[model samples]
Target: MATVPFPFSPVSCAFSRQTGIRRSPLVLALLSSSALLFPVQVHAQQANAGAEATELTEIVVEGATDSASGPDKSIVAGRTLAGSKTDTAVEDISASVSVITQAEMERRGTQNLDEVLAYTSSVSADEYGSDDRYDWVRIRGFYQTSTGSYLDGLPMRISGFTGSRVEPYGLQRVEVLKGSTSTLFGLNAPGGLINSISKRPQAVKHGEVYTTLGDEHVEFGTDFGGPIDDQGIWSYRITSKWQDGNNGADHTEDDRFYIAPALTWAPTDATSLTLLPSYNKRDGNTAHGIPYGSGIDPKTYLGEPEFEAMDTIEKNIGYAFSHDFGNGLQFRQNARYTDLDLTYESVYGATADPSVSRSAWAVYGNSRRFVIDNQLQYDVSFGRFDSRSLAGMDFSYNDTDEHRVFGSASGINIYNPVYCGLSCLTLPAGYDWNQQETARGFYLQEELTFDDRWILTLGGRFDSVTTESAFPDSGLSYKADDEAFTKRIGLTYKVTDGLSVYGNYSESFQPISADRTSLVGTPKPQEGTQYEVGLKYRPANYDALFTLALFDLTQTNVPYNISTTTQSQIGETNVKGVELEGKFALTDQFNLTVAYSYWDAEIVEDGITGNQGNKPQLIPQQMASIWADYTLPGEGIFGDLTLGLGVRYTGASFADNENTLKIKPHTLVDAAVNYQIRDNVALAVNATNLFDTEYLSYVSIYDNTAFYGDGRAVRATLKYTW
Candidate 1:
């Protein structure tokens, strides 16, 4: 549909020098970092190495005393900014929050965002099976694909099929905040939201280069950053990656190219500004499914190789600025603008037959978005009482244009299919439309503490949202304007030196963005309410944190898709769940994590649909996972080895809202092994679904289609760092 040229030529030159062959722009961009950035020199051992090591140790000790560990680099993060726009201890937040650090992601060898969150509590990843197009995730029985994603505290909200994708390599840490959060974030889902912290400039110089090889996959990447001058007033960081591979399906393609360059200007410690800009391109195919009980190979390709395609392009520029006025008061602002385009086409079986009945479809969409948030915080103390007050405002705007087409494809026998190419497929124009939305919110919050043992928090926000949609072919247009106010209150009491109990009540509001005529009539904004209580404990003798939480969350005026072009907002749902999560560093070389979740979710009210008291589709009521990593003492040969293991369990779920079909439960195992080849070189191998388990990841009774879970996957990586 739409195209943009590569911004740099060094990427192509460097790639050609390494591979000895010319390739697409994607491959060229992957290799360009070395040419643009200064190269690192490796030194050999010298006779005075022992003396140099002693001197280095002293420097490290001095640096450690001057600065504390940041949450992005620690395995067990203790502080987070997602809960309150300010840095606060996780145990005192009065709500459930989970953080996945960069070190943890490396240990697990996560390849995508879904895998990065596979072991999180109250999260369901890969709900639609092995799809390379998007990361399908749900939190607490509620889908969050359209509204629950954020980057650096700014919303990455999506409309229709125009969504943004994140590159895990460019992230420092991922934080999950559970329950309603509209009081501070403006608009979101009731279940939760995900915030990804971007990798920024570091005071210390660091650089790494890595290559990975796996089944039908090859990749190369590099990340490096440091001070730009001797005074250290300016610093810069750059990250890039390129991959060419395929998913579990046969005759499919999965290729991507991504790069992010960041710079920070901190003239003084009190004021700082950072600019972040990135570009990403993806080339893949749409997901395909077979009929239930078909006994067909899961990797079978049902679409025409020449006619099937899915490509997306995204570009972004953003900045974060903050300043301290020197008196217990601070000001901060964050903003981002994004442009995204997508082109997708697919052909799949339309009926359960040995000679498949196939249908063809295509969609082309483009979206542009801009979001900004500004905050002011004041901290002061009076006698035995302390207070931290926060006031902020945020604005978000999105514009989207989309076109769809559908047609019929010639039938082919599943047992022995023959290739017909593009001549066998035909598609006609279907729907063409444009939509735009704008939202503005203002919020205020206050946190009070008494005697350093009891804490109270109160927050409220008022939001105004406007949406407009137009169909060009039909000459029809509709507009809606809505306003809402949401509030949150919480209290926490310290029971012991390292234990605390907390309770909270919060609310959320979301405006509908679909066509009014296609819907029942005028649709009202969805509202959500939640009541939660939780316990948090951090051991005094060990580096560990444990949490237990129970919550009751409800959402009214929920919308459901009646067809590809129509929807209705006549549903109300409720979910009551318990979640337990723990992270422990048992010893100097051992780490363990455990998580479990149980949900009782039901459709409480439905007007148009007669089946009301049923469980929502594709939501597992029970899920659990555990991971452990251990490394040997690095004293001699074979001492630099490390091992990791994990297991995940997902309980059964219904295939549809009517609950007529049940999908069986499944459990999968993952493992990793790593060895330090040299002081600056390492090798690692990781495997997921080690047993090659075969089970259903999703099923849709309405379409009579089923998708199989991913099979065994293995990857080996070699990395060099300085």
Candidate 2:
């Protein structure tokens, strides 16, 4: 059987079948935006006749390869460039890295970043349960929210109430680089960073239209791309999604709309320029937390539903340009500018009081950011040694304006609900706070290879960061400035074509949170170091990669105390762990992925006696997962059927720094089935938490709230491609 690329995708708005809800305002806006792009596409098609005709073969980067399959190919492949910012095979990179390809995300029906990385090794996602506001994830026992998240290798600056929410459909792949990355990138966490690669235009035309139906929501999406000119020098891609539905929790809505348009222009074989633009709008309510002693159910909604909503609108525009000189020398530049707006208002559970009365909180914010990076890379060989050197500099600027109000709101019963008008609540007047942060960095790296076996990498960076905060009402201001130099070294020895052993030593520095509330008078930045060793195996004849890694990391100068009277930084943390991961395509019809991790994370030193020597909250000691998929032979009338099964296990952990409250461990099961109706059409059904096991996703000490993980739910998808 021969498979063709999916056809021109049409934007869709899939409302709930049960509720018959209409399209959201956000969707309407996206549809209007789509209307504007179609004209340009039409013009491109018409201009192809007048343009000079030429034949240009597709240029494949050294380590970037496309298998026989289309854009949505199988995940078990052999090439990736995320590890080194250069075209390099994953097995050759010394760091511990994981690549989640688009094919895997589509096969698993991943709707968000959290879901896409759920089964990945050394990653913990959805720490706050099933919230749609952010993709909260931890890497190697450290938070990645503020320090370790990037888009296309550039750090995404998020301050106060502003965040960047990416649409999964617009992504080509997600790369997780474990261990300190300050050596190549700027300041970041000791655990590592996640880089998301955007979908770019392809010389070959492809498109898909799909709709997903779930327990409480429906979503429609499309992806299409092809050459815009007869000479194939110009290509374009457009992707869009619209969804409207409720979450499993009562009165919580998950509505969103997204669109991304990309264009590529290759005037010559050695040079190319691409423009990427995206827009996203989200209108959803925050997931509430329940008190431990409260009789309220985890799925119950205690807030005034009609008066609660967290809405956000964001836009991003960027361009990437690269040109190759002679003799393996290249120049590349990538830049993006973003604007974000958020409006959030909610009444959440405050106490265990059965009456469920609590204070209402509201925040309205606007933010703008700009980031750009440029690099020069050269590949050279002398005798038996090969050297690849890279030099780059990057800068970023961010500004945020926020208004917040906290006031009392009338409480309602969980079992019996009553509508309380917004008039019944009290709100503070005026916009009260503002913040801004700026950062710049310069870096250089060199990779040297000996014979065909030994590889050595050395890199260093210098960074400077500044943050400012103001309170309009109090007439107070705060400022912090930091500068640091970091370095990293790694060596890899290839034992054979299929196996390699590698080791690395790296360092990291993290400045205090830019938010005025946490800036403590130019305090010393938190510093960390790590030593890691790993083995990677890629069977020559099989489409599989297996990895094993062990590492020890320590971070010091943590903020030990923060009070109005005094602020001090005297704390330390240590994390030691081992991880194993494997993904394989045993045969044409069978695929499997397995991951396991064990971590010992503890507070080595702290000002608070009760917290010292305790395990960090929410840092589980053990995690493991396995997924297997099998495709059944196609019979007479039926096309083909693929069934997938997965299991995930999480060990117990402390709910607070004091380690008094213990969260019990739990196991979950997930299953999926895909039935191909025809060569270009298919239906898929996926379910998570199959047994409906209820477990705590997060336990907040300050809020005294417990949030539960997602319950059992099913999603069915119908897709058509050409």
Candidate 3:
């Protein structure tokens, strides 16, 4: 019944209020477009040369430079921004980072974020099986769906089921930073975070259009970008896609429409500003799995088609600004505002019996979030010692409102389900609540390099978080406030010209919502710590990179459900793992990737549940994958042809915390083939789960539900680029 103060103090309250005033979805749309009209004047430098000789000479030079946020033209990326928020070389950072470029995504024919990360080390994509609602991903044995997602180095905060969904086609690359990251980015899971770089306008002209056809599926998309003026003062890019299909499941639809427009104004090489706006809509059905050991078809639809629906609409607008003072100082700012609306309804089997009793549920929700980060970086050199210092402050506010309902549905036979309309269901009024959360953080980082051989990094962050919830129907309210400081330190040594070894220690802090009523007063925030050591190698003679990592991670104050209404935070978990990843461009015509991970996760302490020392549910001990692609040259009768193949293996895991039900291991295969008909046209075919292997991707004993992995799916695509 007591109210808590907001995280922003009086000094910062006015700033927060100004941000809250621009919550209107319609107003944001207009503002996103109007941003281009007001352009500040910038001075361009002129160069003059004098020749003393009788004969004068003229020279012309052309080249392109790579940035942390730019497109990666190759599959093997040597530098990344996600590791340190700067354009830092991968080998110099004292952490494990994996990058998946557009080239790799195209070669594998990835359709979703899950498929894009399917072959990455220390990552488990599609952990919840065939679900159209979200991209369920787990990193280092911890779920990251709610906390560890980012775009353009900014957090994509999600409350409940309201979250932003990304289009893989619009991304230039995906970077995965493994281990605790609160020292750089506040409020995150210990397993690390995934940062996706958006496709931006290019100085050169390029465009591509493609169409894909498959069984019960069809899609069309295009991406084009170029300079808007001859002097290259302005550039623009537009990416759009439409798809209609199903995920090899009966009575389910997977349809989406996505478009993103980007514009950049760079009057000078040192100063640049870019605007990124996007809209996405998805209409599909909820994922309802069959009962465990029910002997029913995996593709069978348990819910009534007439009453099942899951749909979402999301809009986002953001900008990135940077200016270099040319005095060993630089400033950067990034901000984004996101709005999401979701509607979900389903009737699923309630028991594992032959006569399935069904339960109906529906959720209607809306979420809005605004986040901003400002950074100042300075570089100074003193003799043999060089230093790069970064200082930043970030703030985020999230507001969510939801209405939930529950009812009973008529029973159905497992073998043959008789269709029934919504009239046969009994419904009642449900609870409605509104929740708001705010977080503010100030961080500082220092990177020191001595003689260009040894690198040392130190970072610290202080965060203030607050959460408030109110139940309009019950006239009850709950509030919680938390503050914490996280820190990180690392050191890297260049062993040779092409090899390096590094070690790091980092920490994380996450504030939980107040919806989970705590029996022992307010719930404490979750804290995580990790220690990691890794080795990286990049051959100077070839395009290849290899990495090996070992980490020990622990999370404390984990919450567990004590009852239907109450929870307790007397649990702790520890995960130790080893990962190996390699990317190789062995020759001009061959590319290969290999990844392997082994995780040993255990519940170290749980006073209430009495399940201590047991393995956590749904976390595998080992996962390995390999993918290879080759192109063959022919002078006659055969054009340029490419072939690709991949194999993935997921190890066994437990279904419940008690370790009673063991889920068996499974292996899957993926293949692709492409032929270049001409210089500007090509055709390709891709297949996933080539053998149609049937295995359980997830099992919930408490809910009496089990989901099957995706089946064999094949699609053919024709593309033209100019």
- Kindly report which residue stretches of model 1 are placed more than 4 angstroms away from their true locations once superposed: 1-71, 354-357, 518-522, 559-570
Q: lDDT for each of the candidates?
A: 0.77, 0.76, 0.80
RMSD of each: 11.3, 12.9, 12.4
TM-score between model 3 and native: 0.90
RMSD of 1: 11.3
Question: Which of the predicted structures, 2 or 3, would earn the higher TM-score when compared with the native?
Answer: 3
Which stretches of candidate 2 lie above 4 Å from their native place? 1-72, 354-357, 514-522, 562-564
Which pairs in model 2 have colliding backbones? 5-722, 6-207, 6-722, 7-207, 7-722
Badly placed stretches (over 4 Å) of model 3 are 1-65, 350-356, 515-517, 561-567
Q: Candidate 1, residues 514-561: lDDT per residue as tens digits?
A: 456678656878889999999999988666788899999888876655
How do the predictions measure up, each by TM-score? 0.89, 0.89, 0.90
